[model samples]
Target chain A: MILSILAMAFREIRRHKMRSALTTLGIVIGVGSVVALVTVGEASSAKVRADMAAMGNNLLQVFPGSARRGPVRTLARPFQEEDALAIRREVGSLALVAPLATHSGVAVAGNSNHFTNVWGTTEDYVEARGFRIGRGRVFRDSEQGVAVCVLGNTVRDKLFGDRDPIGESVRIGSLSCQVIGTLQAKGANAWGSDQDDFILMPLRTVQRRLKGSRDVNSILVSVSRESAIPRVKSQIESLMRERRKIRPGQEADFFVHDMKEVAEAMQEVTGTMTALLGTIAAVSLLVGGIGIMNIMLVSVTERTREIGIRMAIGATAGEVLLQFLMEAVVLSLLGGLGGVLFGLAASLGMSAALGLPPVFVPWIIGVAFVFAAAVGVFFGFFPARKAAMLHPIEALRHE
Target chain B: MTPLISLRKVCRVYGAGETAVWALRDVDLEIDEGDFVAIMGPSGSGKSTCMNILGCLDTPTSGTYRFRGIDVGSLDRTQRALLRRHAIGFVFQGFQLLGRTTALENVELPLIYQRVPKRERRRRAMEMLDAVGLAGREHHTPAELSGGQQQRVAIARALVTRPSLLLADEPTGNLDSARKFEILDLLLRMNRERGVTVVMVTHEPEMGEQAARRIVFRDGRVESDERLRPLEARTA
Candidate 1:
């Protein structure tokens, strides 16, 4: 019996094909947008996480002073090399600490001159910053005062072309240095800055030859174990404060940043964006449901005589209600299925166009499908009730 | 044996007080099993109202109506619908066959409401269609069939459930003279062969004279009741 009623409902919809398609259009668009937006957002968020992981593993940085200006003490000078040494010596959980100084200069190799960033750090820089050499070797600990440099992938490609750059000579702002190694390729970072667009040299080389300064701008530290990060961070902070002669109650001039914290903040931002877009899409679905309700009410009014005839033929009011309700549900489900296909296509197209990986989450599709059916039930109730409540005699007499 | 239908002082009032219209008033009637009763009246004389009450589509505002010894007025809407589905059938003047459905499916409708299985429903509906001389036209929709064929399909539908009481309101009113006689002959044959209690409402005296019994109404009350050897009986 139920199957027959359902078949009747489908027949009714087929009888008015154009109107049924138009009525379901709203749901299709609503579900399509929701799935596309959520899936693309998920892909972008995953990209953010992958980029964060690429930044460094269990890394932390301590800057000269608090970048935040409100109520925190400002340092009068940049961080000296002694701060990096002190953190390495005093913090037992720390595995490696390297003072970093960066400057931008034109690097001329043979006839090629490319502008790139130059970094000055110790022999421990490669291990602490998660960098691997593709060819040749890093500078020896004893070669700090010598003029030698390691080239990044981008700088090597720009200055050396296809030739071997290990023995080539490059001029860094009037100072000549021999290339000792070439770092492996690392793609763009989270901020979209090219990771392989810089050169690394021993601290004395960049400090003496490039910047002519003795102060290091930042210190990069890597912990030996993941669980030791919090302890090492606090120890480094206290050691820096004591080294800088800050009072017990005074706000420290330096700030320590954990890569995990940055990654979490980025995740939160993307999560909120996905939720906001999802809410807007859900509103569209609600509007689509309202459209369904309007059409269903009109359908009930138009088919009054049909309802009367069915009732006169011994159909109960409940049967009429179920028939109309099932029609609405079937319409929404069809729309939802179409929308899922559309959304997947759209997401794939956008992903290809935007250079982001496509992310398909099963739960989101399941939820959207169920929500569409619920919309049918909720919005279809009023019209179904109106159809069931019609009086057989009055309805039969209706013109 | 108990009568097939009994109505005692049944009254259906439309409104209250000074604006009230009494569609049926203090009407007492009885219909025995296997009886072919024709209800004849002019417009506003309440023949249709009487049919509605007898078909259980409407309840009398006062007094009692009993069908097969069960109080119909006391039954709820669902119960009345079930009673109609299982024990009563109706034919309307409009033919009332669903316009877009095939004649076979239209005959199968009452069986569907009865929740009969698909195979049995098709078999029974086919048998009824064959009985109505529409065997080759089972797949034709109402619009594809002529007026007489449409009324035959309606009759097939009405009898598909093997209803004990068949109530037809102006079954031949829309037919030409020949088609009217054809339908009248069909109804008389069903009444005689199946012993189905057939109650039909018509305005033509000739149609009324064809029934085994006739009741005439005027001003919402029965004016004359007569029993005669119907035309079909004398011919048979």
Candidate 2:
């Protein structure tokens, strides 16, 4: 019986194909935007996570001053080599600690000259900062006092093009340094800055030879276990306060920043953004359902005489109701199918254009499809009931 | 044997209190199986209302209406619909066929409601259409068919379920004089050959005279009842 009713409904819809298509357009656009936006949002979030991971895993950085204190910035006392040593020895679950000092200068190798920031640190800096040596070896401890440097991939490309720079000499602001190795290419950070644009040098070589100061601007610490970061961070903070002779309850001169926290915060922000977009799309779906209801009511009114004929021919009110309801559900389901196809195409196209990985969220598609059908049911009931309640005598009398 | 239909002092009133308009007043009627009866009256004389009651489309405000020994007034809306589905068929004025549906589909409608299998339903509907002299015109919609052909399709639809009772209200009203007798002839043939009990309401005296028995109503009351011919005489 229901099958026959559904067949009748299909015929009815096919009779006025243009009106049915126009009625379902709202649902199509609603579902399409929802699918496309959510898929793109997921892809961008994944990209952000990957970029954060590339920065460093389970890593923390300690800077010399607190940037959050006041508008007028004051430079606190810089960290010493002992501060890094204290963090490695005093803090548990320690992986690697390197005292980092940086100086921006121009490096000239033969005829080629490139402007770059030179990072002055120990051998642990490469491991702490998650850098991979693609060519030659890292400088040893004995070479810390000697003038030696490792070139980033961009610096190699700029200075030597395709030539091998290992064991070659590069002059950093009048000091000629031997290039001991070259780091692999890491494209860019989230901030759009080229990560592979800096050169790595020994800590003592840059501090004593160039700057002539024993100040370490920042300390990079990589924790062995992710779960122990909060504990290790607090321990280092207190230790730094003690070494710098700061009393308890006084404003600390240094701050410990963790990469994991930044990564989690970024994920949360993207997740919220995705939800906001989805909610706006859902509102459009509601409007689409209203459109369906409006059209269904008009259909019921227009087919009053037809409904009367069916009733006179032994159709129960329930049967009439089912016939109209089936029409609505079928219409909405078709729209949902079309929307799914449109959304998949849009998301794929956007992903390719934005250079993000294609994210296929099957559950979201399922949810959107089911919700479209539910919109039909929720919106189709009143009109169907109205059609069913029509009196056979009055309806037949209706011209 | 119990009569196929019995109405005991039936009263159908519209509205209530001082403004009440009685459509049927203290009316008593009986129709046996295989009897052809014609109900004739002017407009607002309650002939249509009487047909509606007999077709199970309306119920009396007071008194009992019994169909095949069952109290029809005691049944709910769904039960009445069930009774109509298995026992009764209706044809209306204006040849009320669905606008876009073909003759074959219209005839198959009642069988579809009865949950008949598709192949058998098609066969039966085709047989009914053939019996109505519309064999080659089964695919034509109401708009495509002539007025006489449309009325024939309505007749086929009325008989598709092989119901026990057929009620036609002004079935020939929309046809021309030539087409009118054609529909009357078909109804007379169905009644005589199949022994199907038929009750028809008509405004034309000539249409009413052709029935085996005729009853006329006026101002919600029975005006006259006359036997035009014996049922056995026509069947013979």
Clashes of 1: 0
Candidate 2 has which clashing residue pairs, if any? none
- Chain A TM-score compared with the true chain A, each model in order: 0.93, 0.94
- Please give the range of 10 consecutive residues that has the lowest summed lDDT in model 2 chain B: B227-236
Q: Which stretches of candidate 1 lie over 4 Å from their true place?
A: A66-76, A92-95, A224-228, B230-236
Residue A244's lDDT in candidate 1: 81
Docking class of 2: medium
- The alpha-carbon lDDT assigned to residue A348 of candidate 2 equals 98
lDDT, residue A112, candidate 1: 95
lDDT at position B146, candidate 1: 91
Candidate 2: residue A344 Cα off by (Å)? 1.1
A22-56 in candidate 1: lDDT tens per residue?
Answer: 88888888898888988888888888878876766
TM-score of each: 0.95, 0.95
How many clashes in each candidate? 0, 0
lDDT of 1 by residue, B160-183 (tens): 999999999999999999999999
Q: Please give the TM-score for the first chain of candidate 1.
A: 0.93
